[model samples]
Target: MQPHQIVSREEWIAARKTHLDREKEFTKARDRLSEERRALPWVKVGKAYLFDGPAGKATLADLFWGRSQLVVQHFMFAPDWTEGCKSCSFWADGFERMVPHLAARDTTLVAVSRAPLAKLDAFRARMGWTFDWYSSAANDFNHDYAVSFTPDEIKSGGKIYNFGTSGFGVEEAPGISVFYRDEEGNVFHTYSCFARGLDMMNAAYHYLDLTPLGRHEQGLPYPMDWLRLRDQYQPAPGKGACGGS
Candidate 1:
């Protein structure tokens, strides 16, 4: 491939204008799809699911935390897993800043995992996050959303249904489920999405585009191998050994 050339000011302006025009078209199409999505039929959640919160055990209704709307992210953390899934952890990290803004809009956001409350708390402490997280240990909430795998699923070696994708066994895919409460205090499931819908949490894509390497791989999952908690990361030898060396 030919090396990219640095363009003059006028050329830069012209290129930017072309990109902006394309972006505008993309935005219009995105908005139209969103409207279509909003028009879909609602599903009523008949089963009463339980979740473990910081304050203690709570029902699905209680997850609203007095807010009229609730948004739950099914985080990947089974009870026995030692650590949260790396990709899901990236998304969860954004919740700290988003929670306050969501609260102002009268929407409460929380992350639910199948892990025990004690285990979730310990992992959160290790990651140094302040966002609200809860345990769904006693319920089939994850399985219901097609985010958790069952023992039978593991044993069958057949296609396990999940997130509109079928192939080998199904594994937890990051997902978002929304719910709204009516005047009668009945909570109705409004919407849910997985995979591409979770793109808002992807900062690596933005960063990769600005780097020389670009995204390096075509079909791989998001580039999670490079990130680490701020305190846990260390620069490699001769990598950060700059000017003096």
Candidate 2:
């Protein structure tokens, strides 16, 4: 932490106004970038990707759930892992509450992981999340989306993600992929964002950004190095790997 500066009312107002101008510019730039993102060309999906969900086996189009637009969060949970990535869990914490709102907008949001459906269901129950989560265990969805890497790729140092083959250490990474379905039932890959690109989805991080501490992640090996599963926070009772489910 740094020393605080005390200033008169007028001085603080002037400083705030100057900062507000920069904030306005940033807002405009962000809107323009969003427009550009929407303008990006779409690619038709040709694979028969399959997923296991609460309703049994489903195809990529089935995951759309009658919605024209679909948003898939590529959760980093391997088939054998009993728990999901803590960072992804942070993002998932606030997602269930947005379901109806996203539904009203004709968009369906769901999480896809390499873990089996049983594992996903149990974990979701433990976390008390209601959002639809599916398993990509029987498909190439994760690998095709560049979120999952093979052991061979790791051994060969040949995995590529976020448009590059660097700065990654784990077999799985987090990302958001968007899709659109046409009236004729054809599906198109719309847009995808990885790394810190998905930061805006975390409300807690946004609130933290508004404070003087500002995420307080500096000097750490990783920005989220301090993160743990929601139940794992000390003084908070941890419900074991299976939780209460």
Candidate 3:
């Protein structure tokens, strides 16, 4: 817990400017990568997937709410589980505020989970999130999107996760999928990302990246090991006072 090398104002400015050049380079490179991602070919979504939301039954196109584009957060809340995944909750905490902004741009953002609508609604209320969350309990949306694995799939080694052949030993995984709807009501899957590819979508993670410690996940069994549901985080040690000897 020591401070970095101290420097005079002139020296600090010079060093910061040098780093700023590298940051700009990275920004440009990221812009190009985003362009490439948008250029990826899309696939037509033929399945008539349905979801149970607060407003009753909804289809994939209906989730868009008259918007041409949709962003689905594949939340990992299994029907058998009492609550949503902590990691998924961490990701969702950043979603509520973006709903209106996304709608303004002709895009809608919503969450899709396999848990029943009542469970999803109760948990959403507990989390105090206003984002539209829907249940895929009656549809193959979660399975088709590669978020929820079937019992047979798990028993035989769930290898379809993250688009890899490695056997994932879990019934649920987190992901995001994007879709587009044309004038004729045709829906298409434009993009989907799993695992670490979703890093950019979490604002807290990006904010952590700007600090000196940068997530501070070292020495842990895994990244996000320190995370908890927003309401579950314990008060910071002493609320900032040092411990007594």
Candidate 4:
């Protein structure tokens, strides 16, 4: 944090109005980009990918829950990992509350991870999340989507993530893949975004961007080094009986 620049009311209002104009232009540009994104051609999903959910083994289409559209959050939980990624968990925390709104739009949003169904269930229970989560352990869905890297690829540092050869810090990364189901039971992959492309999903980050600090992750070891699952935050120093505040 830095010292606040105190200014006269008239000066502050003038500066604010200038910034507001720029913000409005940025908003319009964002709207145009979104329109372009929706215009992208969708590809037909040919693979018969299967997932393990609470009910039992299910196909990709079955996970849509009778909806015509599906949004799958590529949660970064490996089969052997004890917990999901904290950053991904931060994103998942926002998901449960959006279910009804998505349902109203005839879209189903679910999470798919490489972790086993039991692990996912236990973690979801711990997080108190109600959104549907499934395990892609039975199929190459994660690999096909470029969210999970193979052990060999990780070791060699030649894996492609976010559609590039540049490696990621972890074998598993985060992403969102959208699908559209037709009346005839055919499904098409509408779109998929990775890396910073997922910023739209985290409402908290956008709110913070309006503040002085603006996410404030600069100089940290990782951009999300300060992030933790909802329950893992420790009390601030001196907030206890000690005089540390």
List the candidates' TM-scores in order.
0.85, 0.93, 0.92, 0.93
The candidate maximizing lDDT is 4
lDDT of model 4, residue 231: 86
Clashes of 1: 0
In model 3, which runs have C-alpha deviations exceeding 4 angstroms? Answer: 1-3, 237-245
RMSD of each: 3.3, 4.1, 3.1, 2.8
Q: Over the full model, what C-alpha lDDT does candidate 1 score relative to the true structure?
A: 0.80
True-vs-predicted CA distance for residue 244, candidate 2, Å: 24
lDDT of 1 by residue, 1-245 (tens): 23987999999999989989999998999899989977888887889898888988899989888999999988988777888877788777766678889999999999999989998899889888887899988998888877787778767776554444653344555788899887677988888877667775567566766677776664456455666554456667666624343
Error of 2 at 154 (Å): 1.5
Model 3's alpha-carbon lDDT is: 0.90
Q: In order, what lDDT does every prediction score?
A: 0.80, 0.91, 0.90, 0.91
Pairs of residues at least 3 apart in sequence or in different chains that clash in candidate 3: none
- What is the lDDT for 121 in model 1? 91
Q: Which regions of candidate 4 fall more than 4 Å away from where they truly are?
A: 2-4, 237-245
| Better model by lDDT: candidate 1 vs candidate 3 | 3
Question: How would the candidate models be sorted by lDDT, starting from the highest?
Answer: 4, 2, 3, 1
Per-residue lDDT tens digits for candidate 4, residues 1-245, read: 87988999999999999999999999999999999989999999999998899789899989889999999999999998999989899999888899989999999999999999999999999999999999999899998999988778778777487779468767799999999999999999999999889999999998999899999999999788999888888777658434356
Model 2: lDDT equals 0.91
* Cα misplacement distance, residue 67 of candidate 3 (Å): 0.7
